[model samples]
Target: MNRVVTHELIHAFDHCRAHVDWFNNMKHLACSEIRAANLSGDCSFGNELSRFNFGLKQHHQQCVRDRALRSILAVRKVSREEAKLAVDQVFESCFNDHEPFGRIPHNQNEARFAYRDFQNRDRYNANL
Candidate 1:
């Protein structure tokens, strides 16, 4: 629950910080959705296992990509072909933009602010 909330909070923060027009910006929307799906446990192994309800099995990455695809399509409000094209366009970059984790931020300003905030929180926690 906390993880999902924080994930969404990060998206909302991204929108505010980047002045993202979520409804129209296909790339921006896809990028954020990709991040949220990758980070939010939507694609986690445990989560996928829990979501499964049948005999046939599938690869974990496939499950993750499918979920990510559905999420992107939902947000883009476009046909599957269009959404897939848009997602495919930014797939590599967005999938690689995992913040506060393995991937790097595409925007330097976002990285700087995130690093600063992380340091501040670390300092405050150490004091406590």
Candidate 2:
């Protein structure tokens, strides 16, 4: 039996790359909470991005790849009823235990409401 890996369904927000962002060729669309909530371990989209090429035509391709790497480092799992505890834990470690992002919120429910609201607004408008 062969096991095929399906990457955790996620919404990624890649930073703006020079020409790609300008032309809107590359983008980070937010991942789906419904799909991402069920994922285990480090979630990923699973495509192998090729290493950067050099010379005038490809000089900065590596930089573009690097941006993607930095962006992926902050991902956290979502919860069904609230923002997952795992998120704060992961973000905290990434920020070296910074107070705000690292600190656990007083209410997980509020976080879910806020995150959902933002996501819904984005989805609602995106439909139009």
Candidate 3:
């Protein structure tokens, strides 16, 4: 779906802009994966239920964290402890940092192609 594509696109965009060594930088990789999983609707209740059943109604934050952790561990090939440390180190910062939805740019030239921004711009231009 569009969400998944946009999520990976953000990773691509970040790699392009930062020239990050994704293969080696476990922290950076984990951070981006967490952001993508959380922001890209991968952790939505409906999405989760579609993939696996959750008997109890857990908090959304827990669901998001679980989803993010799974994604982070999938790559970087790091031990669980290392991945957990990295995820914990960056979780607060990356999880809160979202584009379009949370438009407080970290810098002057934040990426403008996020889904929310595109939609907002489209709607605004439509009336003009």
Candidate 4:
């Protein structure tokens, strides 16, 4: 439940902050999907491991890409290869754009800390 909310919220946040052409732009959709998967704890270590997806190098990244590809396919009427291409095209930049969290929240504890940091970001920025 929480994970789903967080994932959709990331999409909402992205939509609010960017001129995302959701219907026409595959890259925009792919970027948001990558960000959502990467930032929403959807690809957290525990989640991945429970899904029997672990032990590989760069597993987190692979998880994000796989999840993002799935998400794009779910909402867009596109071929799997096209969705994957879009995800791959924007994976690096989108995966690295840790906006409100400022980092990837890999677990519940990390997510809590990231939320705290997000809540206090304005204070930190004001001091800068």
TM-score per prediction, in order, is 0.66, 0.17, 0.68, 0.88
Better of 1 and 3 by lDDT: 3
**Candidate 1 residues 70-122, lDDT tens each?**
88766556888877676778777767665564433224454566667666666
What is candidate 1's CA lDDT for residue 69?
A: 73
Candidate 2 structure quality by residue, lDDT tens digits, 1-128: 01112112122211222112312221221212212221211221221123322345532322323332333333423332223322332332322321111221224454455456556664657558
Error of 1 at 2 (Å): 2.1
Candidate closer to the true structure by TM-score (higher is better), 1 or 3: 3
> Best TM-score goes to which candidate?
4
Q: Please provide, for model 3 over 1-128, each residue's C-alpha lDDT reduced to its tens digit, 9 standing for 90 to 100.
A: 76779678878766776676787787788777777776666666566679784546654556656766777777657678887787788888878777444543222243344545757765756567
Q: Candidate 3 has what TM-score?
A: 0.68
Q: What is the lDDT of residue 120 in candidate 4?
A: 82
Per-residue lDDT over 1-128 for candidate 4, one digit per residue giving the tens place of the 0 to 100 score: 88999899999999999878999999999999999998888888788779887867898898889889988888988999999999988888998999878988877778789889888877856557
Q: Which candidate wins on lDDT?
A: 4
Give candidate 2's TM-score: 0.17
Q: Model 2, poorest ten-residue lDDT window?
A: 1-10
Q: Model 1: which residue pairs collide?
A: none
Query: Taking the candidates one at a time, how many backbone clashes does each contain?
Result: 0, 3, 0, 0
